[model samples]
Target: DPKVDVLGLPDWVKFIFLDIGLASIVFTCILGQLTTQVNASHMMIDFINNYFAVFTLYTAMTIEFIGIMHCAYLIKNILSAVSGKPILSNEPPKTGFTFAFYWVRVLMSCAILSFCVAVVFTALLAGDTAVSVKYPSISPPLAVVLLLFFMGVVGTLEAMQIAFFSVAKLPPSQRGTNWFGSKTCSLLFDGNGKNLPTFMIGRQLTVVCSFFLVGSFTSLTIVPGTGNNIFGVSDTSQAFLNYGFQGAVMTTILASIMWQYAASAFPVTFLNSLISFILLIVALCLEGTGICGACWV
Candidate 1:
């Protein structure tokens, strides 16, 4: 999105996905080495299962961070719009500006962030606290539940707040093209009669489902991992293999994200970040399942 072309971003930030990919490479190697050193003759199976497990579990965080950055593109556009401004050339906003002028914008952004964190944390703590009584360990299932709770509560609110506020503040002329677009924004911000809760529930369900699908795929790999397999790849190899897939996913996902950013900038950018993100999701699922099947059956 034209919004994504912020000029001031360090080259490193722009290429973070590759960096993440490289880190996964290093992580895989280290994990494999550690497994070999520890398990000696019997390490292969353990390594395979563990390798996949690490990447699968870590995927949650990885996807989430990328998604959040993905959100930044929309945010920048909506934000610059709010300021009655348009980015001249994807240049990064000047730094060292007197906070006195931009504090409201800065504060608004920070408050939204704080609320997102607080709500997610509270929901997680609540779920963990609640689940502990029945399920002792922090199992994968419980983790998913916690994540669902986070998204269901915090994710919707975060999206709503940004979407509405941005949509609301803009002139009717620019507030999305739809006749109802501005109306919807006003409704969202006004906390319309029970509409907010209903919309929130829908959004919550959607996000929770997204997590569940990903979690289900990840669980297939990890849950079986605790079991024994004679010829299963060691956890280390599994992690590296999984890491390789994740690295690939991140690379594609990153490209998609950057494309999405560029697309947001002017009008037409022949790219979509979501395409690769979706592909990455599928690749991880296939690779994760492959490892599981290889070892389990």
Candidate 2:
């Protein structure tokens, strides 16, 4: 029957999600070849000094988006409970003026803000004399600290989302999910006893994000450049990996939420979000293929 469990999920959901994740990974891998050469100023100190900070900010933004998405998914059930809510069945992406839509729009805005930080890198911070003085052309290493900050943001975002979701949605019977780790009395136990919140998605999202991080660094090394352009990632294989990182991370989170939540956001919001997620995931997959090709040679 349709209700059969595949990897602890309904078969239909498992299939759809796997499709989304797989397609994305494959498509992104293809973009890798076009971007890996680094010919113009590939690995140049000036380029790295100029671009690394911005790139780090971008990466952090991307990661933060993923983290927030993760939190939302984790907490979907709990949030519904807070409202004394009930589950809704699966349906296509919809559009409407629902409470869910209002919340999701706000969430998406915050999620997208991470990459928006790149706006600073694109101009304001790029050649800013003030930033240059503070960061210093000679102090490229300081960018590492900036990079750390981005990672911390990602981590904090993830932690915050996880805690909120766990407490709010998860049952007290599911004690293991508690802040101190699962204990004897998680709130999620049924009469027969079972963990209500299945958490495999967290592990899956982590795997997908790890792949993007690897692909990004690897792609950076091999990614060719075109005339000292700041937007090299846009046209090349690196973009696939970079954006794929965005995609895989984003989509995985989305997939989890889709699997767990009630789809109240009407068609436009849902469709747009889905498309954005798919595009990135495919780019990552293609990025991986390119990485493999390089290894074989």
Candidate 3:
């Protein structure tokens, strides 16, 4: 009765996720209002700049954590349901962990490792210290760890996709009368698909980031003596700065649209990456031409 089928999550679980997402929206609204107030008051540029970036990063990470938790639940239920494994129905709590719990733990561990790597890179690359300062001790290990963690996550997703597709491919002869229930396949493959719980959260994260970007520009415009201080955009040259702003806006629009509709995660990820690559190139060109120093930050 508890089999997962195409709906990888229970109704109650879905409701919980909805609540988390709603809560994040509320948080964003509060922060956005605060940002507006700060700008109106003409707060110190240094403080506003730092606060905005840190707040955006924190919100993104917070929503990402929520998404990862949702993903863990969906993955556990789907794997258990499809594999005909015993659900976590029990009379009392046990000291021993179940198979589903182990898998969830593994996924969480990988996520944590990746998070650490991200933190190291962010600190080293974007900290107040000059870029010349080398983090030689941490950089290499961080790269290696991230590479391994990424491989694990990708491999697991690939395995799950393969399993679901194989089940989908089962013929009527293989199954009793009908092919493996079409509903399950549709649930996993159609619309948003079970493979992209994170993308759902990402949609909101993008909106929050976009709002912050807009707020940053607004703060710079309204506050005296803040031009180019926040984003390091050139006061003299507007070409690269304009391109970066446009790119951010377009990225946010794309993300918002995906939030409304059910787009497959794979393509969304690809598009985001492509957009980011182009932005990075623009940033590099700007820096190379001495127009600005990391205006895209």
Candidate 4:
């Protein structure tokens, strides 16, 4: 049976209208900032400088969206467990709304993948000079390597979505025959709990890595006093730290409240907040000490 919320609206409606709409708004705001900066400066240096900052912001936004989705899924599982109601079964789309929603998700995934590829190509064509000059601490080769790693992280996240959708689109018999299809099914359902622990561990690790990677870059390149930017005295590090920590704390508090209402248990919500704090500290340390091989001098 298809999932419907209390208001009788299908799950697809919420996912399409709410989740995608929010992501689009976030992207548009960031993109607008980049566009404004670019339009204000005709020099190549200024353009490249703004590009790096915008790119880092984009990466952080992507991480935030992914984290929110994963957290929502976790809460859904918790609700299902507490209520002793099985999750809605995964079946091929039948209704027009469901079919349109499925295709929209697929197309968005493809668009993201294409955008990632384009960015990678642009970075490569921009060459070592652009990267090295913008991030003067690291050697050109190492800077390029780091940029590629950032791109890879974003690409991999979206690629996983596309892979899952692809697998879901296949016939049940055909899904088992395909490696990604079979693995996706196992990871998605994880009825035996065999992969859930590993999945959560890996996801948390990715979140930490992404936070540090993007944070370190933005700290040096986008932080107003630190970098050669027109935006005066803006501290990207502090801003990111505030955003990350606040987001985690708020999400945890909300989730805990929901859990309390549903299960009548006041569970601790400090884990995610603590993780966010620690990750920010580590990133700040790396940024301050230049221990991550990025000396701004």
Query: Which candidate has the highest lDDT of all?
Result: 4
Query: Clashing residue pairs, candidate 3?
Result: none
Residue 220 displacement in candidate 1 (angstroms): 6.6
Better of 1 and 4 by lDDT: 4
Q: Number of the top candidate by TM-score?
A: 4
**All candidates' TM-scores?**
0.27, 0.22, 0.19, 0.28
lDDT, model 1, position 4: 61
TM-score winner, 1 or 3: 1
Q: How far is 14's C-alpha from truth in model 1 (Å)?
A: 46
Candidate 2, 236: how far from true, in Å?
Answer: 21
lDDT of each: 0.39, 0.38, 0.37, 0.40
- Per-model clash counts, in order, read 24, 48, 0, 0
Tens-digit per-residue lDDT, 175-224, candidate 4: 44444434445544447644432332233334344433443332222233
What residue runs in model 2 are displaced by over 4 Å at the alpha carbon?
1-90, 93-131, 177-179, 182-297
| Ten contiguous residues minimizing lDDT sum, candidate 1 | 267-276
List all candidate RMSDs to the true structure: 23.9, 21.7, 25.3, 23.4
Tens-digit lDDT track for model 3 on 1-297? 234433687756645444224344435633544344434456556555777768988998885554433333444455456555555665564345655564565576446444433433333343311111222333443533443343333332333333333444555233222223333333334665532322222322333434443322211121224452224435443333323333233222222322221112222232223332233233334334432211222
Q: After superposition, how far is residue 254 of candidate 1 from its true place, in Å?
A: 6.6
Q: Stretches of candidate 4 above 4 Å error?
A: 1-137, 161-171, 176-193, 221-227, 230-297
Instruction: Give residue 197's error in model 2 in angstroms.
Output: 23
